[model samples]
Target: MTSNSDTPASGFLPPRWFIRAAWKTHKALYRWSGGRFGLRTPRPDRYGLAYLTTVGRRSGVDRSVMIGYFEDGDGIVTMAMNGWGAPEPAWWLNLQAQPEATLDLAGGTTVPVVGRRAEGEERDRLWERWRELDDGLDGYAARRPTETAVVVLDPRTD
Candidate 1:
């Protein structure tokens, strides 16, 4: 069986365990700090972190996670890459089951949003935007067996 280390991009990324631990720690800090840290606005050449809450597909409970995103016009865009692992992120799955969700931005602002996958030219465009942010974006993405989803979060009108 092939391991992550076998992937060409593995050299540029930290171990999967370390990546997962960092995520957990980031979330814990966000929660413990009362939203004071762990999230920020996206800059021109970098992605920002945000907190997203989606309903569990099966349990119907709210599940929250920290995601990297960037502002696109008035909407937000993120990827469904699970630490560059093979499985889809649970938050992405939940968004698929229920597109309506909420995003907690930095500065304690919350916005209701609807999630969807980008496609065709839209996907290409957004993916390019991400590429400009991280030089190793494609490398990390290639580590996965499948294409990482480009998720767009638009403000909910209703």
Candidate 2:
């Protein structure tokens, strides 16, 4: 099938349902294993996985989800993409509403952070970094109806 700047190639990635299920299973693995599984540190050319907890905008409750990220200086960077779907991820929306959050990394390390969107040159640089990690980054991003936000989670001292 032919693809354009607006339409991403389909066969490159699994269907949306499968992608969602995989993430659900990953979360389950983390929970069932008592946080022993489902997360890894970012290598020089690969992204890391972590569980992020954010406050719900309306419910006022804590919401947590697994996300992929890479360390940048003192902050962590991730994309607000919903499995490459058109809609923005709920976790990202929650972060926008309440930026203060918690990041649960591998080896039982938890870091408090404040989330914000990376803009201008920072966004371009971080987006390019992500492109290096995934060969199909641009293709997957094309599936989104809107531009994806590059989220920066900076460590919160207080």
Q: Which lDDT values do the candidates have, in the order given?
A: 0.92, 0.91
Clashing residue pairs in candidate 1, if any? none
Q: Tens digit of lDDT per residue, candidate 1, span 99-124?
A: 99999999889999999999999999
Winning model by TM-score:
2
Error of 1 at 134 (Å): 0.5
What tens digits encode model 2's per-residue C-alpha lDDT throughout 1-158? 35633332332677899999999999999989999999999999889999999999999999989999999999999999989888889999999999999999998999999999999999999999998898778888877889999999999999
lDDT of 1: 0.92
Window of ten residues with lowest summed lDDT in model 2: 2-11
Worst 10 residues of 1 by lDDT: 2-11
Rate residue 134 of model 2 by lDDT: 82
TM of each candidate vs. truth: 0.93, 0.93
